[model samples]
Target: MADYLLESLGLLLRWLHIVAAIAWIGESFYFVMLDRSLKPAADGDAAIAGEQWSVHGGGFYRKQKLVGAPAQMPADLHWSKWKAYTTWLSGFALLSLLYLSSPQMYLVDPGVNALGSDQAVLAAIALMVLAWLGYDLLCRLCGFREGLLGALVALWVIGLCLACTGLFAGRAAYLLVGAALGTIMAANVFFVIIPGQRRMVAALGRGEAVDPVPGLRGKQRSVHNTYFTLPVVFAMLSVHYATAYAHPHNAWVLILFMAAAALIRQFFVVWHSGKRAWGLLGVGSAILLATFAWLAPTRNATSAVTPNSAVAAPMHATELPAADTAEIQKIMKLHCTACHSAQPSLMASAPKDLRLDEAQQIERHAALIRRQVVDLRIMPPGNITSLSEAERLQIARWADTLAVDPAFK
Candidate 1:
C-alpha cells in the first residue's frame, strides 16, 4: 500500500513537472523567436529598438522591444516567472519522491558506493546546492564575456559529470547531474533574471533613468538558460535508456551527450537568428554518431568461472546449454521478478512494462534483458537483488542462447 501510494504520488508529480516544464520552455522559445524575428519599425520610435507583428488566435499582435525604460510604465505587465518556479518545484518534488524516498532502490548502489540512505540523500542535496553556488559564482566572475564564460561553464559541467559518475550509482549520477543543471537554470530565473527585471521596472516606476546593468544581467542569464534547455531535457529523459548511463565510462558518455545537446542547441539558436550553422550541425551529428557507437553492447570476452563448475564461463552460444529454460526461469524469479512482475512484491510497477511472469514474456523481452542485465549491468537496480557475477553470467548465457530463436532475430 505504501508503494502504491508513493507510485501514485510520483506519477502525479511527474505529470505536473512535465506540464510546467512545457509551459516554461514554450514561453522561453517563443520569446527567443520573437526577439530574433523583430525588425526596425517603419514609423521609427526613438525609444524602440525593434518590433514584430504576428497573427495569433484570429488577432494581430505587435510586440515592441524598448531600448530602455518607456516614458510611462505599463500597468498590466505579464511575468513569465511562475511557470519556471512551478517546473522546478514539481521536478524536485518528483525527485524527492522517487529517488530520495527510496535511496536504497534508486540512489545508492552497493557496487558503486557504500552510502546509507540518509547519507546519500544528504549528499545529493548538497551537490545540488553546491552546483548552484558554483555556477552563480562563475557567472559573476566571468562578467558578460560570452567566450570566456562559455568555456569555463563547460569545464565546470564536465567536472561535475566526472564527479557524479564516480561517486554515485550510474542512474543516480545521471539524475543528479541533471538535477544540478536544472537547479542552476531555475535559480537563474528566480534569483538573477526575474529580480533584475523587477529592479529595472522599479527604477522605471520611479521615473529614474534605469541602469542598463540589470537588463544586461537578465539577458545574460536568459541566454544561458536557452543553452541549458536541451541538455537538461536529455538528462531527464535519459533515465529510461540504460545503455548511456550504465556504461563503465559513463562519465565520458554524459560529457559527450551534453556536448551534442549544446551543439545542437547552438545550431538552432544561430539559425533562428538568421545565421547558417552547418558546422554546428555537422559536429553535433558526429558527436551523436560517436555516442551511439560507444553505447553498443559487446559480449564479455572472458568469464570468471572455472570450466568444471556447474555454470560454464561466459562464452559463445554453442558452448551454452540450450535446454536450460527451467534453470533460467528460476534465476529470473530469484533475482528479477520481485520488481518485474505483474504483481510486483518490491516495487510499484514493472519498469518499461517488461514483465517476467511467463516464458513467452521473457522470450519477448530477451534482448532488452540482455542489454540491461549483461551489457549495461543496470537492472536489479542499485544491486538490491544482490545479483552476483555468477548469476549475471548465467543470464548472459541464457540470453546468448536466444539467438537461435527466429523471434529474436
Candidate 2:
C-alpha cells in the first residue's frame, strides 16, 4: 500500500513538473522570439528600444521594449517567476520521493561507486547546489565576454556530466545532470532574473532613472536559460533510453547529446533573428548519427554457436544455436523476478506490468529482456540482483537464437 501511494504521488508530481515546465519554457520562448522579432518603434521614441505587433487568439497586441523607466509604473504587472518556481519545486519533490527515498535502487550503482544511500542522496543534493554556484560565479566573472563565457559554461557542464556519470548509475547520472541544469535555470529566475526585474520596477516606481545594468543582466541570464532549454529537456528525457545512459562511454555520449541539442537550439535562435544557419542543423544531425553508430551493438561470429558446441563443432556464422530454455528461465528467476513478478517483494506491483515469473511471460518479453539485459545491460538496476557478465552473455546468445527460430517464441 505504501509503495502504491508513493507511486501515485510520484505520478502526480511528475505531471505537475511537466505542466509547469511547459508553461515556463513556452513563455520564455515566446519572449525570446518577441525580442528578436521586434522592430524600431514606429513613432521614433528614444525611450523605446524596439516594438513588435502580433495577433494572438483573435486579438492584436503591440509589445514595446522599454530602454529604462517608463513615465508611470503599470498596475497588476504579471510575473513569470512562478512557473519556474513550481517546476523546480515539483521536480525536486519527485526526485526526493522516487530516487532519494530509495537511493540504493536508483541513485547509487555499486559497480560505479560504493556510496551508501544517505551519502548518495547528500551527494546528489550537493551536486545541484554546486552546479548553481559554479554557473553563477562564471556569469559574474565573465558576463562581459559572451563568447568566452559560453565556452567556459560548456566546459563546466562537461565537467558536471563526467562527475555525475562517474559517481552514480547511468539513469541517475543523466537525470542528475538535468536536475543540475534545471537548478541553474530556476536559480537564474529566482536569484538573478526576477530580482533584477524587481529592482528595475522599484526604481521606476520611485521616479528615478532605472539602472540599465540590472535589465541587461536579466536579459543575459534569460538568453542563457533559453539555450539551456533543449539540453535540459533532453537530459530529463534520456533516462528512458538505456542506449544513451548505459553506453560504455556514457559521459561522452551525454556530452555529445547536449552539444547537439545546443546546436539545434542555436539554429532556432538564429532563425528567430531573421537568419538561416543550415550548417547548425547539419552538424547537429551528424552528431546524433555518430552517437547512434557508437551505441549500435557489435555482432560476434561466436554468438551464433550453440552452448553445447564443445562436444562437436559444425556451425556456420548464420547457423544459430538452440537456446537453452531452462537456463534462460533460471537466470530470469534469479535476477528479474524479484521486481518483475506479479506479487513483487520490492514493490507493491510489477514494474511496467512486466511479470517474468512464468515461461509465457518470459517469452512475451524476450525482446525487451534482450535489449535491457543483453544490449543495454541495465536490467536489475544498480545490479541489485548481482547479474553477471556471463549471465548477460548467455541471454545474448539466447536472444540470437530467437531471431532465427520461430519455435522458441
Give me the runs in candidate 1 sitting further than 4 Å from their true place.
Answer: 300-323, 405-409
TM-score of each: 0.92, 0.92
> Mind sharing the TM-score for model 2?
0.92
Counting clashing residue pairs in each candidate, in order, gives 0, 0
Assess each prediction's global lDDT (C-alpha) against the native.
0.82, 0.85
* Residue-by-residue lDDT tens digits, candidate 2, 308-373: 211123344344434566788899889888789988888878888999888877776777887787
Q: Which ten residues in a row have the lowest lDDT in candidate 1?
A: 304-313
lDDT of 1: 0.82
Write candidate 1's Cα lDDT for 112-134 as tens digits: 77888899999999999999999
Number of the top candidate by lDDT? 2
Runs in model 2 lying further than 4 Å from the true structure: 303-323
Between which residue pairs do clashes occur in model 1?
none
